[model samples]
Target: MDTPDTPHVNKERIDTMEHLSAAIGVSRPTLSRYFQDPDNVSRTSRERIRKGLERVEYVPNFFATRMNRKSTGMIGVIIPYLNDLFFSRLLEAIERAAMDVGYTVITQCSHSDPAIEARAAETLMSMNVEGALVAPLGNHSDLDVHERLRSRLPFVMVDSRPDTMPEVDFVGTNHYHSTGLATEYLARVGGPPVFLAMPRVNFNAMERERAYIAKMEQLGLEPRIVGVEGVSGAGYFEAHGQAVLEREFSSGRLVASSILCVNDRVAIGALRAAATHGLEAGAMQRGGLRIAGHDDYPLCPYTVPSLTTVAQNVDAIGRTAVARLVESIRAEKSSGKQILKLFDGEMKIRESA
Candidate 1:
């Protein structure tokens, strides 16, 4: 008897779909159609293919098969930065959603650079991808690159959309409502918090700042905006945040009694700065500053005193973006009607206000 580990025994088994079809007395084309979609084959042929698969343990090479077709069966996912936990988590969710439908995800990070973003678009276009989901670089993006690509393929914009691409499909959180939610909560429990703005790198930040100003005005309070200057790139939020806070403290301008950061990263930076100055942060800490942020990032719960934040439905965003793109790809035409899907944010009140 041949043992399972015997080399010759393994070599005798069918390894490819062509060999398996020959062994099962079925045509190779029939087997290929079944592999593409089992429902496409007749019941008798499907049963035969299933039996053959059980005997040989053959797994089809998806890439090799896709190369022969016009559609690559690949979806491109583009983001500004992968090191940021927000984008990384969003990418993972998008990948999961795409794989569930038998499509592969090709991810590219722009590193917050417009030139690199344009290059990434060109690469995806050259790949002949079935569709693409892009989280654009906001104001810094090249509109011509996106316009040319969208003219030829189906693309869904995730998170941020360029103003020039108003006709494109979009999936994102409602920044205005979410920011208002956070601002209102902070004002209700603590003194009206000052808005700690990050450098205006993206539309999301600008929306948050606008929302903060609007909410403060509605409450009949003066809106104080302290922005971090001369900072860009990943991991700069905390450092610039700390520097901005230090300046505010020394200048006696940190008078709001609380600080609402543009995002969780900036809030974390402010927390670090407050700690360095021997000032405690959180609602329960007396004589300390109340701090809050947006996005409810992965690390928010583990912060020194935890964090209060507005949590965007990232999973929903990813799933919706993929679904929309897939629909467009199936339609094979860019619909003149543009669709916008926005998910709401939930406020989580923690120890930090």
Candidate 2:
């Protein structure tokens, strides 16, 4: 049943309905109607369409055939850093899930910059992305950009939280509870000495800080919360971060065996600082100081004597974010208020505490 004008003979390219209508002498519209929800059409016509479909290869242009007139078969996924394993793993999962459903995924990195994040969102919107899955830089993100996109494109926040963008769905860890676990682990193993935090501007980090303070108070320990001063991006291997860690290391009052970090990178920097002062970061029984981190990075296990940390389900976060965004796009409505989808983060006890 080869049509002279058929573009390709692949199983997916066949115009089964058209070919069957031509062969069985049925109108194209009636044949089309029969193909879409066969129960709605006459039993005889449905049977004929089914037989025709089986005889010839064909796949509907789901982008065109979907009941929703607006879905574009494309989704935009944005993450804070593409190089970070947590974000990268999440993106890979999202990309895989999107491809499985025949949806194209366009990924971008905000580089933890607000302007860049805004530009990236605008770019995706201009391309007419059906939906977006963003792991924003939290406070660094431009709320206006998100607001505009929320008005038109379906979007979800993954792995990060803004102040309160009610228009978008949020999928991430419950930092407050997760950080409490981190604190409790520290109290049980090393005792809480200092909790390293970044700017209070980040909603998630703020939650973690509050959890740390609350846990410290509960355990009747003096909470020494240290904020890494300077720019927001400085938390990531910036010179200011080194200086901050240096000061922490130099402060002789920090008697706590383990220091809780905002994230893996911050812990890494602090660990390096401790090492510079000839302090070993490992189990006390093994004759070394203890350090603990959050968001177990890929290199955590490789850090000298290994780094103990909290591990979030990065892959699950990405998969769920994409699935949720796709559903919102298909639903053609964002009225479903921002859902705080929190996945439990587990503590990986290792050499460091």
Candidate with the greatest lDDT versus the true structure:
1
RMSD, one per candidate, in order? 3.4, 6.6
Overall local distance difference test of candidate 2: 0.74
lDDT of 1 by residue, 41-159 (tens): 99999999888776675778876667667667899988998778999889988999999877899988888889999999999888878888999887878888888778877889999
Best candidate, TM-score:
1
lDDT (10s digit) by residue, model 2, range 109-195:
788889888989988887778888877777767888888877877778887777667546888887867788888887877655578
- Among residues 3 or more apart in sequence or in different chains, the pairs in candidate 1 whose N, CA or C atoms overlap within 3 Å are none
Per-candidate TM-score against the hidden true structure: 0.86, 0.76
Displacement of residue 60 (Cα, Å) in model 1 is 3.4
Residue 318, candidate 1: C-alpha displacement in angstroms: 1.7
